[model samples]
Target: MLVKLGVNSGFGAKSCIYMLASSAVLRRQQLVIRCLGVGGYSNHNINTNQKPMQGVGFSSGASLEADVENVLRAITPTLDPNRHKGQAGNIAVIGGCREYTGAPYFAAISALKIGADLSHVFCTRDAASVIKSYSPELIVHPILEESYSVRDEDKSFILEKVLGEVDKWMERFDCLVIGPGLGRDPFLLDCVSKIIKHARQSNVPIVIDGDGLFLITNCLDLVSGYHLAVLTPNVNEYKRLVQKVLSCEVNDEDAREQLLSLAKRIGGVTILRKGKADLISDGEIVESVSIYGSPRRCGGQGDILSGSVAVFLSWARQIVTDENLSISSRNPTMLGCIAGSTLMRKAASLAFENKKRSTLTTDIIECLGRSLQDICPVP
Candidate 1:
């Protein structure tokens, strides 16, 4: 029975008064990556015999390794004295809740530390204070609400309110990082789904990670086929995504081919599969960054990667018309992933050198500037 309803339509299935929410199965379609690239970027497999980089060093001979450094230097904007605030980059992170405050803080602050002019975080009221306490440099909006604090009757109004708040600042952000420490709360996830929709409508690029991947795996419609989207998934997260989208186990022997297929299957959105060597694919080509990296398997590093990718991707997009980018048809999202992964690996290696086994995510964050400077110095 198709019941014609007005007020109940906007509210989801879980809304108060129990209204049926419409669900439509999105037909999977293959969409190509938008036409933006350097002329000659190549796909090269990781060289197992390649010696590890020493102390923020660049690979002297590996073509792919050298290509990564070149991409980083090319996309990173030069610091101009006349440039106004937010021109370098304005990154917004949409995550953080009662159970997770540090994740959002790490992602937001890392953006600023990596030279983004402004960094903002939208988190639950309970997390806003804690995140704010971590850094005065960040702009924290205590807007998102969790299930416990919100009554069902208020969910509709509250969801609209959340979207409105994000709408005000949506146009100002160069890029959005969608999941860091976001917990797996049903109501909060529902609100985030709406936010993702709004972001897509605005044509803004997003970096999905951590809990965002979880939200996306379940609702592939949220990000599937959005070329501006980039998903950074670790091992477990990648496994789930492959199973959900490709219906098969991860084939380590043909990891790049599988990643390529997975990206193509999802409509050309770039996927940065984090592992021993970060494998990046945008359905068109595959690139790997296996340079110097730390052996430490610490938490919060992925948050740092998500934030850094947001900045670099924004910068890459800003220079699409430059004639100097002749490496190949390297999409901006792919370039951002390569640069972010290389920088993260460099910083981690540096941190591990200093702190040894004591190296932490904070230590790695501290090394980002130095690592970048070593690769591409500010003249």
Candidate 2:
């Protein structure tokens, strides 16, 4: 029987069987979400004062006037002695190349600081040692290959080897943070494409940012129609996506409508369009997290957002899908984006309060725990 074979087989064989079973379960989970729609827990008891956000120009807009702080508290699991490693979250960052290393480090480490039990970095050989030296906490794998190192004749073999390395641990990861410090090399992009495809096939949620946005923008089909996909695009990136998909520029006046259309065009994947006020939509409704962070235009903040989101979203997904957790919206991706954005902004504000104009990404990350505690105090 399949069960007997799985138990008797070696690690490789067992993993293959487990992955197949997990994929089937994930498909069923998505089916459940589709059936639930707006009939989630919030419908049972509506707050008269709190209003739902209506999606402008889209019939799917049942305005989700979500109390974000409540959603964050609802999803964050209590610290339990019964819980072991990887139970909280096991997140991975699929980036870090010769040209860039700090971005991936910021992301992978941010996931840990934000309460993920374990964090990992999958990068190139050249960047691995540097990334490892940055911190001893991360489990770093230098499995990625670029054009300079990969010869044309051996590209096929190298690509398979890279994918195999990731496949060994793919099923165990709760979420993947893609594109931070991921340089745009043709061969490297090709390999990353395969990884994204595999992740999509396995039904794992992915937070795409940095160069990852670049990859998905060109090939919208990679994330199109995949409900678990969350795209966190900054000003420039959002502009490109709007131009490419909707064939128009970013419309500030009709921001929510444009965002809703963009998500709809991409087959209902969630999008967090970052700016002074973060706008999130899943082609259903638009929600904004305008809690002011610092005015500092520092780099690497996006990495922090991406990593924080992966953990929160993973927790949100686990909680929502387990049994209807009490929250306004049913979409974990949207909730994750909201929580992550709110936390990031609060942390940034706190960091700026302390460091003033000198606030850096690390400073913001350090404020995450405190900001989270401020909103939802643990007993």
Candidate 3:
């Protein structure tokens, strides 16, 4: 459901939300809404003609195309020769267990591919080496413990140890992507819950996806009112959120209103609802990135999005105070979702063009650079 944005006076009005549709309909149409400036309301409809995957430019007819372009350029950091290694972004993924490693790796590595300076993975020992073998670039920490590995008596000690390992570098990280391949081990999830609390306490932004969605759905307070938290949920996950929070079925008739209410009810966190068009909403405003992306619903695409959002959100947070940007929303989380959703759709379209039906998540990851370059060219 399409809805216009309303301006809110508060800085962190609500959470930014995006919904993705895993279908061919997502291939061409994209609409972006720029809710004027602070304390004012202006809605611009940037809808491209529905067509197959074309490169960066959508139908020239969409009037606000330049505004969308400006949003991406404004949030993305300029490459500087004198900057330190971690200046661009530092991202950590809190997931990966014996059964799942690729999700965390995808989430972590995508952050780097999208220009994050450093990417770290905190996972169980069983998955650490395998994920490391996947990429030597990642800094893998095998500190998490599943119930099977820890004695009942050691749970408390081990949990504190895990938190300590994370706390050492927590402040250094720009953002944290939680729940990539995190298995729902009672013990492991319990540990991750504490980690989430600490991240929140430290005021770090988090993008939650995959199994991470499962953890917060059951325990809403983990992310309940944190505006910096982003939840990326596909069809089923979105439905669950509707059930638990709104206590109703997925209301397609008034989805925009429902989404806005959901975000507000959850204490103003941004939600990216994954569907045909990536619909985003913070408690205060709702926006959409309807650009046509690939129809190939690969398993790890969401992981890529989670990682990409972490990087962009970090960048957005850094630039929120800059007076040069034209956009209105002071909410860095919303801007980050806009930038990340735009880039992901562009890369997906590019990958689908090259690999057709065989397109994998890795192919899309590889295209991130080219996509960013296309949108924000360097002088």
Candidate 4:
């Protein structure tokens, strides 16, 4: 009956229904895109025959590692004295809990150190004060609530309040870095699901890492086919992702192809498989950023990548407009991942060059600006 009603509508009525459905889908898509600072349908080319621009391959002695450096140079916006605040970028990190606050702080502050104008953190009340205390520069929102704090009778009310807090500022953000220090609390995860849905509704780009990966691993629908989302996972996280999505063990020999397939299977969302050489793919093209990094595999480096990617991805989206160029074939998320991975590697290499055995995530973050300056020097 419902199917018959859907089908029996006049051709024009059917077209209207289709258009309405498409508009809703595109609206959700645009919410994320706009949050990343990219304009909507204006950038879409109806022809679908457009091609991407040609580029020089990564130089000799340059593996995916070398590619990262060059891509960083290519995408890092030149610092102009004339530009005002927020023009560079605005980013938010949506993680941090009782168990972990340093991760979100690391991710958010790193965005600032890397040149974003504003950085925000949305964390649990317990973690908020600590993260806020770590840096006066970040705008910390103490909104997330753990289950232990709320009674079952008030769950719906509390959930709505949490959603309201995040939703109020949803459209203002360019990108959200989810799952840094996010703990494995059932109630907290449920709240984050609502937050993800809101971000999706607002068209906000999301970079999932840390415990955020854990949430998505369990509920794949949250990010399944969202093209604007980027997932950064380490060796262990990658292994788990493979197991959950592919229902099998990791195959190192065909890692790149498998990663590529994973992104495709998940609806063209971008994935940055962090490893000896960070492998990135949007299911279509595979790229690697293997620049020499420190031997010291510190814990919070992935946080830096998540934050850095948010900024670069936002910038890439800003530049890939119809007015700027005719070729709209490229994926801004892919470009952002490429540029972010590249910059992080170069910074790590520079940090290692200086700090050597003493290198840390903070030290690498400190090198972000210098790395950018070295790659694409501003006048």
User: How would the candidate models be sorted by TM-score, starting from the highest?
Assistant: 3, 1, 2, 4
- Over 218-248, each residue of candidate 1 has an lDDT whose tens digit, in order, gives 9999988787799999999999999999999
What C-alpha lDDT do the candidate models reach, one value each? 0.79, 0.79, 0.79, 0.76
List candidate 1 stretches off by more than 4 Å: 1-63
Q: What is the TM-score of candidate 3?
A: 0.85
Better of 2 and 4 by TM-score: 2
Instruction: Single out the weakest 10-residue window by summed lDDT for candidate 2.
Output: 1-10
Pull out the clashing pairs in model 1. 38-328, 38-330, 39-327, 39-328, 40-327, 40-328, 41-327, 41-328
lDDT (tens digit, per residue) of candidate 3 on 1-379: 2234775735532322211111111121111011212221111111221212122233445444444555777777667563456667789999999999999999898999989989999999999999999999999999999999999999999999999999998867778999999989999999999999998877778999988999999999999988789999999999999999999999988888888899889988999988888878887888777777899998999998999889988877654545445354657787788788888888999999999999999999999989989988767
Error of 3 at 289 (Å): 0.4
Candidate 1 whole-model C-alpha lDDT, 0 to 1:
0.79
The sequence of per-residue lDDT tens digits that candidate 2 reaches over residues 36-111 is 4532222211212122222112223323322556566666666655445776788999999999999999999989
Write down the lDDT that model 3 would get: 0.79
Candidate 4, 319-377: lDDT as tens digits:
44322232112456767887788788888989999999899888998898898788666
**How many backbone clashes are present in model 1?**
8
What's the CA RMSD of model 2 in angstroms?
11.6
- Candidate 3 stretches greater than 4 Å from native: 1-3, 7-66
